[model samples]
Target: MEDDGRGFSFTVGSSELVDVGRDSGVWDVFVQAEENAPLARIGRLLDDVADRKEIFVYPSITLGATDVRPYYTVDNDLSLEVARQN
Candidate 1:
């Protein structure tokens, strides 16, 4: 993860990362899985945007007109993770 004077940018493998600007007050991520098993949650992505606290939620991925992928959020406490790597 890297913050380039704007927002955060995560390097998901070797692909070029998309920068999420802090001024936009939005953080978007893609939840991918090959199987039907559910994706695990670790924590909430919260940021103070324009003096207002907000929890960042995952929105739908829009790459093209016919390439929109919807995603869902799962709630989980990081405190409950015993020696688990996030």
Candidate 2:
């Protein structure tokens, strides 16, 4: 949820959908989740990219990759979680 100072924060939820972030014209802005944990849309990422944004809608419908590992962990944890925590 940290802003990279790029004006728009990474949006995993739609401004009109999940009810996260503030409407900032072209894009919505979000802050880093206060208490990020597994199984939540924390600011975890892959290849220096956040993958959660695509999960706002069903991965299949939004053209997001569906990985059983992230949502369904052996410990029932997220494969991608807060980068700082990782």
Candidate 3:
């Protein structure tokens, strides 16, 4: 993810799950939000990298869920999925 403070950019590469075609590479993107963010954020981000569009960005999100772990004390698990942008 690349950001210029006022705006940000994401680059998608090949050899990813979203690869739409060969010669796939980084695309372009735009984002805007008010008090609420759009759900397309996930798709856009995932698709961008996988489909060779661009990096997708959504407003920061806060999720809430019950803790079911018995011995695990970790509160959150963050994971990143990498796919081809093409």
Root-mean-square deviation (CA) per prediction: 15.2, 16.3, 17.9
Residues 18-86, model 2: lDDT tens digits: 232322112222355446833333233444434434443322121122121123233222432211110
- Model 3 stretches astray by more than 4 angstroms: 1-4, 18-86
Least lDDT summed over 10 consecutive residues: which range in candidate 3? 66-75
The 10-residue segment with the lowest total lDDT in model 1 = 77-86
**Alpha-carbon lDDT, every model:** 0.31, 0.31, 0.29
Q: What is the TM-score of candidate 1?
A: 0.19
CA shift of 74, model 1, Å: 4.3
Cα shift from native, residue 79, model 1 (Å): 20
lDDT of 1 at 45: 44
TM-score of every candidate relative to the true structure: 0.19, 0.18, 0.18
TM-score of predicted structure 2: 0.18
Candidate 3 to truth, TM: 0.18
Regions more than 4 Å wrong, model 2: 1-11, 14-59, 64-70, 80-86
